[model samples]
Structures are given as C-alpha cells and as structure tokens.
Target: MNQPITNAEKLSKLPWSIGSNALVNVFVQLTFLGSVFILFLNTLGLDKSQIGFLLSLVPYTGLIALFIAPLIARYGYKRTFVHFSVLRLLFAALLLLTPWVVSNFGAEATLLFITVVVTLFSITRSIVVTAYYPWAQEYIPKSIQGKYSATNNLFTTLAGFLAVTLAGFVLDLTTGLTGYLVLIIIGVLCGAVAVWGVTKVPGGAPVEVGRGVMASFRDTIAALGDKGLLFFLAGVGLITLATVPLTSFVPLFLQEEVGLSSGNVVLVQTGVLLGGLVSTYLWGWTSDRYGSRPIMLSGICLLALLPIFFMLMPRYSPVSLYVALGIAFLQGIADMGWVIGSTRSLFVSIVPPEKRSEYTALYFACVGVFGGTSQLLAGQVVQLSSGVSGSFYFFVVDAYTPLFLLSIIFAIASLFTLRTVRSDTQVTVEEFAGMFLRGNPLSAMTSLVGYHFAQDESRVVAMTERLGVTRSPFTVDELLEVLADPRFNVRFEAIISIARTRPDPRLTQALIDVFNGTELALSNIAAWALGRVGDQTAIEALRQGLNSKYHSIQANSARALGRLGDAKTAPLLLERLQNEPDIGLQMAYASALGNLRAKEATSPILHLLHDIQNEGARRELALALARLVGDEGHFIHLYREARADFGTATAQAVSAFKRKIEKVLNSETKVLSTLGACADNLARDQLTEGAGYLAQLIEVLPADHYDPH
Candidate 1:
C-alpha cells in the first residue's frame, strides 16, 4: 500500500526540511558544536584532553547508530527522526546545569556529569541524524539534490553566523559560566523549534521490514565491496581528519595564544560562517555539473595551506587578530567545498536509495570514527606540545603549531585517495583547476551563469554561439549541457558550437550520444560536428551512423568520416559509395573517400562516374579520383574547363589551355597541391588574380552554355 511521492509533492515538502536545518544550525552554533561549548568546558577548569573527549562524544554516538538503524527501518525514518530529535533536545537541556554542577560538585565531578549528559544527547542526535539522511533521499528529488545541498548550507551558514554574533556579545556582557548558561538555554529553545519543523516535512516511510541485524551487518560489509563508495569514504575520512582538528582548536589558539577576549574569540567564528555563507552555493552549483571529485580535491588542497597560514601568524601582534579572522574566513570557504563535495558525492555517486538507511548508518559510523579520533588526538597533541614551544626558523612555534602542521600533512596525503575516486564528469583535476586560471574568467563565468539560468531558447543559442567563438575549454561543459535541451534548434546550435572548439574526447562522446539519439536533425548535426572535433575514438560512431535509415544522417555521417580523414575508414566509405542508391549519399561517400585518400577506390569511382547520369555525382567522382592520385584540388575546375567548348575561342587562348595539359602529362613530379598546379598551368597568381585567366576561362565555356549580354 506504499504510494510513490510525486516529484511535485517532494518539492512541496522541501521548505520544512531546509528551514528546520537552518534553525538547528543556530542551536548547533550556540551550543557544543563550536566555540561556546569548547570555551564552556575550558571554563570548568578542564584541560585540553578532557575537552577533547567531550567533543569526541559526538562521533562516538555514531557507534550506537550502527545498532539503532534497523529500528528506523521498522518504525519509518521520519517518525524515528522526529521522536529522537525531541529526546536529544531533552538531554541537551542538561548542558544548562553544567555551571550549577561546577559551582557545587568540583571540576572532576562536573566533567563526569557533562560527559554522561552530552553522550546521551549525542546518542539521540545520532539516531535522529541517521534517519534524516534516508529521509532526505526521499524528500529531495535527485534532480535538485545538488541545489538543495547548497541551499541548505547557505541558510544554515547564515543562521550560524547570526547565532555566533549573538553569543559573542552575550558572553562579553556576562562573566564566565553565566553567559554559557544563557547560550545553552537559547540553543535548546531553537532545538525545540527545529524538532517541530522536522514534523512538517514528509517521506521517509520504512523502506522494508524483516531485514534484521544479520542483514544490516551484511549490508555494511557489502558497502565496502563497492569500490566507488569505499574510495569515497577513504577520501572523505582522511580529509575530515585533516580539517576537523584545525576548526576544533582554532578558537582555543585565539583565546590562549593570541590575547583576544572571550567575546571577540566567539565573534571570530562568525568570519568562518560568513565565508561559508558566501561560497557554499557556488561549490554546490559547480560540483553538481562538474562532478564532486574535483570539488573535493580542490577543497582539501586549499585546506592544506591554511594550517601553514595559522602556524605563521604572529601571536598578539597588532594585526594578529585580523590575521586570525582572515584565516578563519578562508578556512570556511575551503571547508565549504569539502562539505558540499562530501554531501553531494554521497548522494550523487556513493549511496543508493534501496540501501539508504543501512549505508547512511555506515556513513555516520565511518565519519564519526574518523572525526572523533581526530578531535581526541588533537586534544592530546595540544596537551603533549604544551612544553614543546620555540621558534622554528621564521615561524613562531607554539602548542598549536604542531597540530596545524599535522593537519597540513594529512590534508595533502588525502589527495592521492581523492584522485583515485572516479568522476562522472570527464573534467580532470588539472582542467577544473585551470578552467578559471587560463580562460577569460568573465566570459567563462557569464557563459556558465547564462546557460544555467537561460529560459529563452533563442538566448541560449546566442550564448552557445558566443561560447564557441571564445573557443575556451571552460565553455565546453556549458555547450555540452545545452545539447540536452528539448528543443532541436538549441541542441543543433550547441553541436555546431562544440565543433568550433579545440578537439576534446568529451566532445566526441557527447556528439556520439546525439548522433545515436532519436532526433534526426540533431543526429545529422552531431555527426558532422563529431568529424570536426572527434579523434580516432569518433570513427566507430560515425561509421555506425552510416547505417542510419535516414539519408540525411547517413550522408552527414559519411561526409564527417571524410572530414575526419582517417585512411582506415576508406574501405568502408568506398563500400557505401558503391552500394548506396541515393545520389546524395553516393556523393557523400565519394567525397569521404577522397578526403581519406583511398587510392583503391579511384578506378571503381571512375567506372561509377562513366555510368552515373547525374552531373553532381560525376563531379564528386572526379574530385575523388583527383584526391587519390595526389592531384591538385583545382584539377576539378580543370576537368570542368576541359568538358566545356573551346571551338569559338582564339587560337592563343585554346593553345594556352592545351599547353597546360601537355605540361601536366610530361611533369616529373608525382604529386600536385592546388596552388602549385595552378601556378604551373595558369598565371603564377591564377588563384588570387583571376583577371589574367578570366579571358582564357571564358573562352573555354561552351557556346551553348554561355553568352555575354
């Protein structure tokens, strides 16, 4: 009795899902997710290692999710998510009691209480999050998932920015644990609003039942067998380890190392959220079409440099605060790509709908293990490096610098794994990186934006034409995207534009798709365009296109094969020429044979020329013969003159024409190019200054075919 949700209904349910995420992001920002919670733990006299374990608890909760996933399958994803969200919030409210416990029970006892409470909250939150992923898979249609990820990030980031800005001032206004109390209270209230929003969104019914613990275990094992999913997880896990530590510790570095106030330290996080707010959508938009692999790799590479930047910042210099803010902002932008790429790669390439719940649980566990371990290690590293401070060459060494350098090394090491992950888009890492570097950035940006938002087919065609004229590699993706337009004119224009660019293998593949597609108009253009842009890879497709029942398609494909000029296809062209009944296709095959330099077809073509009654077909045959023998292209024009009458011409004009043929007959040279033959036979500049040969050419025209008025 399960009914499929129509795409329209799914779209209608999106606002609740995204809006709820935005609200929860505020709660996350104000509470344990960022600076406030870390500073709160630090306020209770807890050292680095103790605070690290607290942060680690978030991921440790994922271990429980491994067991709780089947419950979601039995009860339905949305219900479990809604129910657990409230339960998690109740536990989160216990965080408000931290200062009271610390005031009476001492640091050790307060640490124990906070751990127990946060762990319970984290466990509930993990189950809620595990259910949310499968819920999202159903709630958001595949067509818009890329945009939705970006949109969700955008709104959540704005909410986080606002929350941090508010929390920063609240901490500045009140002293110590009291400010922390206010923030937690606000966070819990926001959490309540977020839980209500989760109830309004639809989908996430139980995918199936009776797939018990053993089946879930098998699914987890089976996921590792998928090379794409495995490699993706490896790349993401390494990156998470590399980047998470820096984000976790940056606030502490600012507060303890650089002399920023608690409020200003919290406000610095706003820079990170602000950077994400600006750039997250861009990462999503590009990765949606360009493939997430580049986005993922590019992000981690950017992140790799940030740790080094942090290592070099002068502690407590006048500009150190500004420097800290800049690095935090840059980290946000770099991390946005990682976030978008990871989320998109999971939905777009890694997990499938049928296995959503189980795979999601595996994802949570994998990320949690990596992230939790990184935080714990980072804290321990901070604790261990406390005595290990000095200057390393030009850099100012501190307890934090070692952790930053460690993050940098791991960030770079993850590159190899990212490269191994497959990309659906054909763009290589070099090409994606070079796209803005080498091309006209404005033109590339304009083309991408115009093509993405283009509603008018005419405007799209115009943009397609302009992009072709730019001949930039960056424009090829947009041009290829246009080839899928439902309107034939738009697709036809895209094919022509693609042909005008430098040869790319993707161009050949895309053209092959259109040539093989059902539309004949696009098929013909795609065939012709393929010959212009395709490599040897395109020969097979063009050859197969010759088998199409439509003469226009066959003719274009044959002509394209000729244009491609691969001599290996000459035999196929000759066979088609000999058997095709259509005069148009016959001409096309003959032309293709000539371009391919198929010397074997010359005699057969001559026989066809002698037998065929059509003038145009015979002309094509003559040209084909000329090409095979390495004669000048102008030989076709000479053949026309010879067929015309010279009976009424003066003796000198007739004599000159006769002399041209006699010289060619006696020439020692075996091959003749067009200009070389023209110079030898006519005036030296006969092709350019036709005035010298105009009289001679006119005199040779048949008296029956020509008359001067």
Candidate 2:
C-alpha cells in the first residue's frame, strides 16, 4: 500500500538516514556493546563465563532471522525494518528495570531477566540488520555508495566517542543505580530519534517470491561454492576466532587483572573510536586506489601484532593502561580496514547484485556460528585456566596469556587464507606497504618527521618541544629534513622547532628556500625563523622578500631584517616604511629600525610616529625613538602604550621591553650619558624635564641587574 520512493527522493533523504543510523549506533555502543554494560554486569557479580555466554548469545540469536528473512521479503524491507526498529524502543525502556530486578530477585534472577531482554533486543536487531542494508541499496546509487559508507562511518565513530566519553564520566561520578538508569533513558531517547529518521526515508517495494525458505537456503549454500567467497570466508573466520577471546576478556582483564579505574578503562576503549574516526577515510582512499586485497592483508598483519602487545603488558601499572590503549587503537585501525576491504572486495564486488541478500545473510550466519562457538570455548578456556601459571620459553605465562597466544596463531593463519583471495588488482606485501607509507599523507608526514610507526602528529610535535631541552643532534637533523615536507603545517612546525636550537648554515639555507617559496603563510613563517636564526647570510634573501606582493611576506621580511641588525639596510627599511600603506607592516618597519639603531632613520621614524594611529604601531615607534635618541621618556611612553593596547599580553610584553632597555643601558652607557648632557643643554634649565627623566631612569634601573659574564 506504500507509495514507491523515486531514486531522486531516496538520494535526497540518504544523508539524514545515515546521520540517524549513527545516532542509533551511539546508543547501542553506550548501552549494549560498550564497557559500561560489562562493568555494570561485573558489579552484579556475573563472572567471565556468564558474561561470555551472554555475548555469544547475541550472534547466535541471528539464526532467528533465518526464519524472519522470508517474512521480511514477503512483507517489505522498509516496513519490516521500521516495525522492528521501533520495537527496539521498548527494550530500551525495559533495560531501566534491570537494577530493580537485581535488587528484588538476586543475581541469578537478574541474569535470567537480562538474558531474555537482550535476546529479544538482538533478534529484533538481526531482522533490522537484514532489512536495513538491502533497503539502503535500493535507495543509494552504486556510484556514491563508497562515499556514503565512509561518511556514515565517520559520523558513527564521532557519535560513539561522545557516548563513551559521557557514559564514562557519569559512571565515574555516580556509584549507584542512578547512573545506569540515566544511560537507559538516553538510549531510549536516541532510539526514538532513530525511528523518526527511518520514517523520513522512502519505502522500497516488497521483494517478489515464488520459492519457499528451503529453496532460498539452498541457493545461499550454492552461492558459497565460489572460490573467492570461500577464501574470504576462511580469512574472516580465522580473524573472528582470534578476536573472540579478546572481545570477551580484554575488558575483564583491564578492570579485574590490571585494576584500572573505570574512567581509565573507558578512556582506553575510546581510543578505538578515536582511531576509527581518523583512519576510515584513509582506508577508503587506499582501497579505491591500491585494491582491497592489499588493505585486507595489511590490516591482518597489523592485527597480528596486537596479541604481542597484550603479552608485553605489565600486570599493574600506568604504563600497562597506556599499552592497552595502544592495543585498542591499533585494533580499531585494523578492524576498519578489514571491514571496508572485505565488504567491498568479498561482498559487493564479487557477489551478483541479485543474490546479495542471500549471500550476505549466509555470510553473517557463518561468522555468527563460528564466532559464537569461539566465544563459548574461550570462556571455558578462561574459566579452566583461572589461577593457572607456567613458564613459556623465557617469559612467564598466566591464565590469560594462552588466549593471546591463540589469537596470534589464528591471526597468522588468516594471513595465509588471505593469500587465496582473488581481486581485480594485486600487489605484493612489500609493494602495498611501500605505497601506503609513500602515498598516504599522515604516513608520509610521520615517517618524514620521525620513524614513528603509529603516525601520530602530536608525538612529532612533542618531540619538537624537547629539542632545546634535550639537545639531540640526530633528532635536530631529522627535524631539519621535515622542513621540506609537502604538508605546509608540518614544514612550519619543523622550522619553529629548528629555530629554537643554535644556528646552523643548513638550517639557514632551508629557511631561505622556504622564504622564497610560493606558499605565503610558510614564507612568512620562514622569514620569522631566519630572523630567529640571526644568520647574516639570509639578509639578502629576506631583503628580496620585502618586495613580495603579499603583505605578510613583506612585514615578516622587514622584522627579520631588523633582527639581523644590519645598518646597511636602514635606508631601504626607511623608504619601505614611508611608502607602506598597511599599519601592521609599518609597525614591523619601525621595530626593525629600532633593532638596527639606524640614526639616519630618525626623521622618517618620527614623522610616521606622528601620523600612526594604531596603538601597536605607536608603541613600536616609541621604542624606535628611545633606541635612536637614548631618551628615558620614550621608554615610559612605550611601556604605557603596550599596557593599554594588549590586555593579557601587556605584562609579558612590558617585561620583555624592560629587559631590552636594561641590555641597551648596560652596553651603551657612554652614549646614554652623552644624550642626557645634550638634552640638558637643549632644555636650558627651564623645564629640566630631561635631567629629571634621566635621574628617575637611573634610580629605577637595578644596580646588579646586568650579568658581567
């Protein structure tokens, strides 16, 4: 009875649908799949086996959809999807009753209650899952599916981050039923929003059917005979086997074994969401350009390292928390790549569109059966090995250690299975890694900045901060090479870092080249670095930059020229100052004149000072006047103007100005004395203002302030 949705209308509503789906995922992660749920159950004294059994039940519940899928096709994908999705709102409300059930009926009854509620939630979710994707395929055009999926992932990750962070903070603050109840309320609200979003999406036609459910199952089984699908399934099966133990026990290990605070545990889990947020686009780009097989293999290889990191974690320390966080982040990256690559290569690219629903259903069924069995077995393994310990090779092994080792073995086997996967494009492992390191922006920048494998920019920036404090020549050399990186921000950071160290000719030339480059922002930053380097050789290049069409380049060049203190460039600086229209550039010229102490610049500087209205320029002109004539009154005027113009920056600027004044006073005492005598004669005892100002300056100047070294 529903009107058919036109393709154009479907496209129009696609973004809203994706956004709403992301909101639903946030609620799911916070309540069902998240650590908070596990922690809440742990608080109820439900041990590893019980928790694992509950988790295993989630995937196994997917079998219910085997019966429901036929009904879904007979009824309608959209109608069935909306009906069950709205029904999920009831489960959200039912979750609020858990604390009350635990209080009245004891842990055993609470567990039974939770099991029934969650099983229903999972079954409804399974039907919705079966319908949702096919419904999406009907509306989304094939060409933009990749982009749409990536955007959906981004939104989902961002939403999960918010949900986890908020839930963690709430649980940290509250110790009782109130926190869990509040989270349930939030989940219900988000569920309602998700249902509303689904209503906005147009409905698709119900699929036509002639055969029974048995024929559909036979067709799905027959489709699995494809070699590529079999190989892909083998790889996914191994990965799921490896990850089952981790998914079941890692949260338990962190909270129970490591004794990490709940807040810290949530922080570690949030790292996975953060990593996914960052890497989804990169994986998408790599899959499109290089081929999904390379990405899949690469992801598997990274995943293989996770068990090793787990093995290396200390029993109880802050360092162990960080290591676990690192493991979670790596897991996120690997999982994202694996999902995108497998979905694109194994599911979409390989299966015929007509058979997609059946094949996809069969795929989930295989994963669920194998993955659920692994979880149950892993739970038994953990239960049997409780308090068991031994020595393996040189390292001590414990009950949880075998699980990680098993994961490693399974992960390595998945790589072998992955070798059998067929794709339209192919590359060797070495070539794939090379292309990723060279072509990906973050990867290339990280390698260039330092050899950090994680490719985190903050780590590189932190290294830059330690340059002066640590004084490592090797590190400085590596940072210098970063100056030529294609990313402008990285190059700018490198320049700033290098400027903090002692000057070198290599660094000077690098700054010179950047100053001459076409990027105006970098050019301006390079000018500042050259000035900080105090390299006289760069003066000519900086002088040329003064003629640049960009005002920032000219202003920065003039400031750098002043920092070099070359008196020979005074006339040119003076000429630029008179002709310059921009008030900020004029301030740079005046400050430069002060740095150079060019007596010949006095007339033009004084003329411009009278006409300048900008407070910053007026302050700079006062400093220039004091530097030119050695007048104490000019210093006082400069301090007052600086204090008035810059509110919070005023104190620091004034202190720096005072230091500059002291330096000049100590170095040029004879010149200052001569100027004071000349000022006395010019005033001729009428005002005696010059003598009074000189006396006040001498009184205020600290006698021991100058270091004699």
Candidate 3:
C-alpha cells in the first residue's frame, strides 16, 4: 500500500503541477482551443455549423470522463494524467496531416479527418482533466487553495497570452495552412515538455481496485442527489449555456461581420487574456478573503453586460474593432472571476473530499452535455436567422443580436441560481455587492479625502484646484441632488464634496443620517465627515455615535470629537481611554485628548505610551504626546525611530514608513511649529538635560520652517 500523503508533501508538489498545467494550457490555446482555432476553421471555408460542431466535439466527448474516473482511480492520478497527456500529444501531431488529407481527399474528407483527430484529442484531454483536479485537491492544501488557484491561473494566462500573440503574428505573416501547421508543431513540442513537467510531480495514492464500474457509477449518481450540488450545477449550467454563443460564434462574428483582419482578431483575443492576467490575483485575493459566492455574483453581473457591449458593436465599422476589443478585455476579467469563483465553490466547498474524483467527473459531464448541446443549438439559431432583421423598439434585432439577448437572459438566471448555492461560508448578495463597490479605488479615495482632512487642508485644497481646472463645481443644491444617488459611494463622495464647500444645517443633517445608516463603513466615514464640518448640532450626534457597539464607530466618533476641539468632551475621552483595551481605539482616544489639549490626559498618555509595544500605536502616542506637551523631544524621537527603522527594512516597508513620517511632519504644521518653538525655548534657556536633544533636532531641521507667531 502507498503511504498516505501529508498536506506538506502535497504542497511541495504544487509547483510541478501548476507548471505542467500552464504548459498544457499554452499548447491548447495555441493549437486547437481559443479564438485562434475558430479563426483557423473559418479560414478553411467552414461555415458556422461546421465550426460550432468542431468546437462542441471537445465538450460532447467529455461525457466519457464519467466512466474514465474509475480507470483513473485504479491507475492513480499522476500515472493516468501523464499517460493520457502523452497520448494527447500524439493526437496533436496528427493535425499536421490535415493539409495532406485535403490534397488527396478534398475539403469534406479533410474535415472528417480533422474531426476524428480532434475527437480523440478531446476525449484524452477530458480524462487528463478528470485525473488532474482530484490530484490537485490532494496536493494543494485547502488553507491556501484560493491563492494557489490564482497563481495557477496567472501562469496559464501569461502562457496563453504569449502563445496566442505569437500564433497571431505567424498567421498574419504567412496567411496559409503552412502557418497553422507550424503552430501545431510548436503545440506538440509544448505538450512533450509539459509531460516531462508532470513527471516531476508526486503521484497520489491509487483507489482500491476491488471497487467495480457499477460501484463507481452508483457513487456518482448518489453524489448528484445533493441539493446544494444540484443548485451549483444549475448555476454553472446556466452560465455555460448563456456563454455558448459567445465561445462558439463571437470569433466568427468578429471576423465576418466586424471585418477585423487576422492580426486584429488576435489582438482582440490577446486583450481578453491580458484582462484575465491582470485580474487573476485580485480575484484570488477576493475569493480568499470574502468567500467565493460574492466573487461569483459580481462576475455574473459583469458578464451580463458583455452581451450588451457585443450588441453595440456595429458591423463593418472601423470603431467595431475597438469596441470588440474592449468587450473582449472586459469579458476576460468576468470569465476569470467565473472560473476562480466556480472552482472554489465546486471543488473546495461543495463536494466531499473522499468522493471528489467521482463528483468532479459528474460535474464536468453535466457541463459538457448542457454546454455542448447549447453550442450546437446556437449554431442552428444563427443558420435559421441568417438573413433575418427586425426592430426591437428603436434598436435592430439581427440574427446575432437574438443570440446575445438570449445570453443576457440566461446570465441573469445564473445570477439568481448562484444565490441558492450553499457553501461553508455565506455572504448575502446585498452585502457582497456593497463590499465590492465600496472597495473600488475611486470610492476609497473619496472616503479618504472626506474623512481625513479639513476643508482648507492642503490635500483638499489641491483637489479643489484640480476640480476648478478640469471641471465646473456643482452648486450646493446640485450637490444636494447627488446626495441621494443610488450608489452609496456616489452619495458619500457628493456629501464630502459638499461639506468641503458649505456646511449647511441641511447638509449636516444629511451627514448625520448617513452616520446612522446600516452600512458600517459608510457610517464611520460619515461620522468623521461630521467632525470636519464642525457643526455644533452635529457634535451631539457624533457623541451619540461614540456609544455605538461597533469599534469602528466608536473610534471614528472619538477622532471626530477631537477635531471639533470641544474641551467639555475631554473627561469622557479620558474615561474611554482608561477602559478601552484595543490599541487602535486607545490611539484614537489619545489623539482626541491631544486635540482637546486636555492637561488631565498628560499622565495617562505617558503611561499608555510606556505600556504599548505596537509600533503603530507607539507612533500615534508619540504624536499625541507632542501635541499635548509642546515638546520637541517626542517628534524628534519619532523622526529618529522612523529613520532607523527605514534603514533595516525592505524597500516597501521603507516607503511606507517614509510616507507616515512625511504625513506627521507636514500635515500637522501647528504641531511641528510648536515643537520648533519649544526647541528654541529650551536651547535659549540652556536647560541642559532636555536642551541638548532639542538643539540636535533643530540642527536636523530645515531653516526658517517654523514661525512662532
């Protein structure tokens, strides 16, 4: 019996598996997969029906994978994957015989020969896929599976991008069967190297041979009875059905209708792969952090927009290529999200590990059957409506337009079905959508500007200058109109922009309303914005926010109260500081106390500073101490420590510390000037113990930077 594989041993084999997988993907994309392959068939004078039929052969033949799973179980994953992979390479080499077949037997015979070769290749490839997934599950630890999947996708995209780009250039230069044959030769070589890579990976344990074919078939049937699994299958099935027209017909549409050259077609396809390449890591991060459900929903929603973009591309127009390319790039990103999200949902969360091979085979069979049939049906839809045109409202509903419209309907249905997918981790659709939107760079920037700076502060001042230079300002009432915008980020940005210009009572109440809203992140930003507006009426509301249960609300409320500079709230801040054990919350209280210039806080601040060991909390305490004491020593120590830490750290860490130091030294002009004044006083009075440190700090400072007045 084989020794049971530990997680560590499995993890050690991931690099080999991932590398082999990427190499195989490159071979497929370059030779018989992707838009390039469809374009190749088009060049041979194959109609939509023939091209779709050829494309569907791969998935339709994948049904054989259900029976192949048992063979893989007996043979072992590594042995089966490696053996079939080597056989698939020989089938790829047979593509070079296509030109010879056409010369001797005519185009119809050539098509038949090509079909036989591809069918074998497809069936062999499907067996490899069946064995590969279970192998990966055993090899890659679940703890880092999302990250590992992302990395694997990254390699695949990079390889695909390079391979496809080269094939496009070759096809553009040669423009005949010769160029395609050369691509096939290259693909076969890649497959050979990929097989060698696979050989390096550790072979997982084989299943017991005593389990007969009937037993395996029964296992697969039982696995399909799972309701959660059924819902997941339905969701994936809808998406695959929706996208059939896209995968099967879009390349034909682009070349025939959009009138793009082979070079431009490759460029558009490359753009899509580029989009996937860029977003693979981001999708992985999101999947790992938030769970796969939100990523799936977000991807489906984005995918629903692709058909609309496709519909917008005008036939035979110069702009159509650009529009098609843009659509392809966006489609790539959406597709990647779908791939990553669905993989996690299906392999990691939904199916049981013991029966993973059986369930994986079953899942692929469903996709292959449904998705393959959809492609064939879509081909007939195109052929039946070939010359058809009509008006749907003001827009023309052409034959192609109907397919896209059908795709849109199915995409929406997939989104709803995905909501019912049960996973170990659950995120509500609403919360997931909100999190994704709020995490956008524009939204995050707007919130940063709103919460962190006063109206006349330099960052806000610079922003106003840019706004004035580039665009007209919204009138107060116009800004108010935007305050009720549907997107929370939009409304949040509008409220912040309005607060910068005019802090009216109505605007103050609007900010208060947002602060009391259900979106906790937005509510925290609103509280901080209320402080920046400095409305006395809002101060009471801000105080009420301090009593909220959420730590963020309490922290932001403290920071806001400090910005209001209310001496009366000093006692309350001091009490909170004494009780608050969270170091970050303690830092907020310390900053608030300093802003209030509460002398009562001095001893507690010093005590907290001495007791705290967290670097961030220490920096905040030092800044607060400087603000309270008008002492140069605190800032001097902070600056020195930041510099010393910067020297020994990585480049990224150095840059971060440098930014933090600059924010302190520059953003707080009043604090820096006060520190300078205290330094001068101590030096002039010859207070020897403290004066020496002050003088050294002054020597390091730029001249004429501090104005005591």
Global lDDT of each candidate: 0.79, 0.73, 0.77
Determine which window of 10 residues in candidate 2 has minimal summed lDDT.
Answer: 646-655
TM-score of each prediction:
0.71, 0.61, 0.65
For model 1, how does the per-residue alpha-carbon lDDT over 66-152 read when each residue is reduced to its tens digit?
Answer: 777887878899889888888988888888887688789987899899999988978888888888888888878877767888899
Worst lDDT run of 10 residues, candidate 3, spans 465-474
Q: Measured by TM-score, how close is model 1 to the native structure?
A: 0.71
lDDT of 3 by residue, 426-545 (tens): 666576565444324444334334433534445444443322222222233344555675656556666566556535666788788888989897788888888887888888888888
Arrange candidates, best TM-score first. Answer: 1, 3, 2
Cα lDDT for residue 648, candidate 2: 27
Please give the lDDT score at residue 129 for candidate 2: 79
Which pairs of residues collide in candidate 1?
A: none
Q: Please, what are the lDDT tens digits per residue for candidate 2 over residues 591-691?
A: 88888877777777888889878777686787777777656475775466645543323334334554566566766564445445434443353235544
